[model samples]
Every structure is written in C-alpha cells, then in structure tokens.
Target: EADIYQTPRYLVIGTGKKITLECSQTMGHDKMYWYQQDPGMELHLIHYSYGVNSTEKGDLSSESTVSRIRTEHFPLTLESARPSHTSQYLCASTGETQYFGPGTRLLVL
Candidate 1:
C-alpha cells in the first residue's frame, strides 16, 4: 500500500491568499510528482522531484513551487492563491509504478 499523505483534503481560500499544500510519503521513493486536475477531469503535470534537493517544474503552467529537503517529504507552495489556482492537487510516488496520495482539493474565490 502507498504510505503517502496530503493535509487539508479540502480548502476554501480567498483570492490573494497564500496556501501551502502538504504532501509526504513514507515509502522513501526518490521520485515524487504533483499533478493538477481540472474540474472536468483533465489532469496536467505541474511539478516533480527526483530526490532530495532536486526539483523541477512539469509540463503545465503553474504558479507554485516545490522543495525536497528530505526524502520522505515534498511540499508545494503557492505564493499567491487565485481562483485560477482552484483545482485538485494530487501527489504521487513512484517505484516500478506510481502510488498516489489522497488528493487535496482547493477552491480559491
């Protein structure tokens, strides 16, 4: 089973606010990823990490940042929250296959 976790499964934030979505995995997988899902169910890669101190933005456009200081932790930060940033964020870890955490759904108004 996957040992990954995400806090505040649902969030309602005002526009211009700052929000941090927490993501952590106890599996020690070196590869961690974050994907953004639209309301219509289209998913897009937004950020990823390939081990400690290694992080890169994914294919999609995102205003968030990610950091990997410890192997079991990868957190995403949005400096300013907006209604455009309202979406479901999914965190995942990969070995031979990917294991996902329960997604965090954010609604910025």
Candidate 2:
C-alpha cells in the first residue's frame, strides 16, 4: 500500500551469482527501510536511510549492501549470493505512516 514497487517478484539463481534487488517509491518519502524475512518468520531490518546520501545498517547484519543515490530508488546488492542469503526482501518508505512493497522472493541454489 506504499506505492512502492519491487522488481523480479520471484527469482531463482545459483550460488555465487551476484544480484541486485530493486526498490522504488513514488510517494517521495524521506525515510526508507529494507527487511529480510523467511516463510512464516518475523521480518528483520537489514538497512535503512533517513534521506538521500544518508544510509545506515539496521539491527540485523547482512552481507548485502544498499545505496541511496536518489530519493525514489533504493537498491540492495549482493556481491555474491549464497544459499544462506535466500530470503524474501521487503522495501518500505515512511512519511507519517509506513508503506511496504509487495516484496521480492529470492532463492539461491
């Protein structure tokens, strides 16, 4: 409901393959967040940004890195994907309220 969109709604890739998860919002929010979740599990915050040029790692440690080059776009990149990295990635933005994208489901074989 956040007017946010995530690309590659589903993906299956081999181990060691580098991949990027794309997230974008049209609401012009200054705060954005990324979370990782497994099936029937709680979401873990992996990254967040207060605004453009300002990013911070979340409570959860992640091998993936993120960038906030623009206000509407926040992409997470995995230099090398692994089976352990397999999980669903969620993108969210906040103003007075939080909005979340549909999420991207990734599976590393």
Off by over 4 Å in 2: none
Q: What is the C-alpha lDDT of each candidate?
A: 0.94, 0.96
Residue range with the least summed lDDT across 10 consecutive positions in model 1? 37-46
Error of 2 at 90 (Å): 0.5
Segments of candidate 1 deviating more than 4 angstroms: none
Report the error of model 1 at residue 62, Å.
0.4
Question: Tens digits of per-residue lDDT for model 2 on 1-109?
Answer: 5589999899999999999999999999999999999999999999999999999999999999999999999999999999999999999999999899999999999
What alpha-carbon RMSD in Å does predicted model 2 have with respect to the real structure?
Answer: 0.7
TM, every model: 0.97, 0.98
TM-score between candidate 2 and the true structure? 0.98
